[model samples]
Target chain A: MDMQSVITAAIEAVAAEQGKTLRPLTDDLVLLESGLDSLCFAILVTRLEDEVGFDPFTLSDDVYFPVTLGDFIRFYDDAARSQAAPTLAA
Target chain B: MQHAAKPLRRWLLEAERGRGRALLAPGTRLTLDALADTTGLGALRGALADRNVLVSTGSQLAAAEALVELDGLARRIVLAPPDLKPTDIPAVMAGAGIDAVLCDGDHPGFGPDVLIAVPGPRVPLPDAAAAEVRDTEWVLLTSGTTGLPKMVAHSRAGLIGAIDPSALAPVWGTFYDIRRYGGLQILLRALIGGGSMVLSQAGEPMADHMARLAAAGVTHLSGTPSHWRRALMTPETASIDPRVVRLSGEIADQAVLDSLRRAFPGVAVGHAYASTEAGVGFEVTDGREGFPAALLDADGAVAMKVEDGSLRIRSTRTASRYVGGTARALADRDGFVDTDDLVERRGDRMHFVGRRSGVINVGGLKVHPEEVEAVINRHAGVRMSLVKAKSNPITGAIVVADVVIERTFPDTDAARAQAGLKAEILDLCRATLPAHKVPVLLRFADALAVTPAGKLARHNA
Candidate 1:
């Protein structure tokens, strides 16, 4: 699946968990401003781990914190790329 | 039948005359004299001479000293935990009508007139002040809610009514901090029985506290089911050997009781049912999850009945009222207080069915989240589980769960292993519970959030 669709599905999952319906999102949307506080962020990350794979934050070798929803998608994209690179080369 | 009641001070003084030790600290044993000589006793008694005091302290030793000294001086005492946010203190102080604080800081906005600095020279209460402590209320704050702390008032007699004057004086240890209701009961039970207690510090690490209890040779230990679960997860718990193990403040499932038996061989495990609003209700000594159904009509001191799945209790030991707040009768005109704790009759016993308001309704069928959580928690890989309700169009609501995995695996294959565990959990639930009760969605939380009172935070959404 493409990164954009993957990220949108994860966000939708979190919103459903909170009993909320989210408006369509854009790349420039700040994650902290998405009404997801520290508590909701924790649940969101948990859901992301299940739908996608491991938490991108824990999988990456270097420290990378995402600020906007676009950055969050890019972070996951980079981690997925790195994971695939090892298999592609073999 | 017209006997006069003795003051709280007199009863404590009589207990102090016994040869048993009063407190067991890390390296020191405290008799009643040593307890009286704890720092700032004189200053506390002096400040509490004529007015009510808000005793908010982080130190358990200081709290014990303040409680005894306040009672000795016939001073009205309200216990407000110091860990409360600065914003919540003023309203609590106002509600309790507190005139002074025994802590060192003016953080509660209680100026010089209110703050009583400890570590000052000792000044004992004058003999006249100890004449009689009557018509005084001991106010305790509830910990579960987010709004203003609910202030509960209990008469001195009512507080100690259920404490049997047994000659056995076993050293005790408790997981509850003394500020909360569950902790206060253990403290009073030990003191009134002329026994020593290893007080658990508020911010101390559980492993460290368990080590201290081991060092103090804690023979009697009581805690909530959550506390026991956490303790059993660590190796430090193996150092302590308790003869009398009591569980309260939450439901004691057979899993926890069986584990306790395995951990401490030959230990007598008992679970008691009590709350801050409702005094000591009843105890089940027969290693079971619920009380015997026969207790509803048993000629016990406390009368109990299950009405509409909620336990109603009527006893002389029930608390007086909420001071300065509307007094909601815990019982009906017949003196039965609706405890709000839901229970279901299972054959010969009544099993706890969680809180009434917390139940998850799935397609008009009632599902107790605690019951589902209990079943999930029994799984070996599950550390803790929170069963919640999710809105669905077809079925009014659907059951879901968030669990913390206790076992760790390689980082490369963690998700796959977690998926397997989730499958196992789902299979177990399907086999044990009804179709409607099984969780449709099971997610993994790094750690489940617990309430300040050490209970699982349910239905956060």
Candidate 2:
């Protein structure tokens, strides 16, 4: 699955597990308003990390928290692409 | 050279106080004189004499019945709770110098060459006479989740210090497993202080256990605040009309205390501080969350001092020494056991914030999960909450929480009252706690998991 599909599926799984229904996974949808709490997001991140090879959240020196569904998917994809082809970390 | 302390039977506060009162459980009922003649271990009595014996009974009631007979005969009595990991048996037995294994049915297989069968309380009074009793060392295992459990050795007097030598016998009940320190205290209280006790069975549902306690007419009931909170959610809670209620093992937050007061009106609800290593520290009785500040200054039987935010206790109730796993002093130079429980002074009273080693380092700022959970639990809608850390690349970790809502509140969807409840809980946290300690995210769980020891299970992800 692509990063977007994996992230969306994880969100659905976590939300269902927490007995929550998602509002929408649109790019502009605010993360806090996505009917998922921080704990659910943490769980989603964990699931995504296990499905993928790494977590972008732990790779960067600068503190980063994806604010939306698009941002979360993009961060994972970027991390995956960067790992595929060696590039300067900066 | 010293004479053995008064034997356990001699410590019975009132031999004839509560007539017909017996140690009660699901299938067995043993009166105080249940072992006057037959002990089931008659054949092995000579083999176990003067040896360190491990009481690895199948049930707490069985263990209780065995302790009554084994105390004076055995040089050391090591209590092994039923939930002890099978792998920890060797370390525990070797550390306690266990020479024999006593059980209701079969032994744990690896402990010792000598395995003694305990007939429990229901055995027919046999021809064998009661075993000789004496003052013996009582070794209790600390319910630590990680690594091998610590073995804290205690003298008979030290273990029973909190128990008054009186004739007031009230049927006692507790949520603690009998082998742990807290449950042992309740057992000793019932035995030495002239009362019968109803023991909780392993894997019994909370509601069924409460119903059993109610059926047994338990007057003095005690448990951790987590145990009480989970119990309150069950419909059986209001049925058990306890005269005296006690909370230990975890921080008794104000919300739980208030809820208990409402549930059992006119009952004496109290919170006490105690640990396997520290013994029975003190009890806070004024219907408050934390103890009074004057407790440290007063000339009381249990001397306490707070230095560098940690509570230190010096009392006869404190365990004498650590027996196994690690070799470290149980008490300091001044005979004070460092509780390692941090506290903060709030005006005239001080509240236990959390354990010193349990801090969640959030971006270099320290946050105690118990302290944060206490604030969140104060919210009316919250039944119980567990605050723990979630790993984050930026700050290394972020505070998160799992909240169990009061049963009355409906949460069909996260967008319904749960959102409002979350907002209210977050507001409560923000109003009282700092920004960092405020749980960044809270998940609504039907129930929060509690450890086998009955404390809220706190695991950082």
Q: Write the per-residue lDDT of candidate 1 for residues B298-364, one digit (tens) a residue.
A: 8878989888779988887877777765545545788777888998889999999798778887767
TM-score of chain A of each: 0.78, 0.90
DockQ of each: 0.03, 0.11
TM-score of 1: 0.79
Score each candidate by Cα lDDT.
0.74, 0.81
Candidate 2 CAPRI classification by DockQ: incorrect
Give the residue spans of candidate 1 off by over 4 A. A1-90, B1-4, B16-20, B24-30, B36-39, B43-47, B111-129, B391-397, B410-413
Q: If scored against the real structure, what TM-score would every candidate get?
A: 0.79, 0.84
Candidate 2: which pairs clash? B72-B133, B72-B134
Instruction: Name the docking class for model 1.
Output: incorrect
Candidate 1 local lDDT, A1-90, one digit each (tens) = 897887787677656645555655778788768755443455555556667766676676676668888898898888778767767546
Instruction: Give me the candidate number with maximum TM-score.
Output: 2
What is the per-residue lDDT of model 2 for residues A1-90, given as tens digits with 9 covering 90 to 100?
778888888889778656788997898788889998665666666556667867787777777788887787788898999878866864
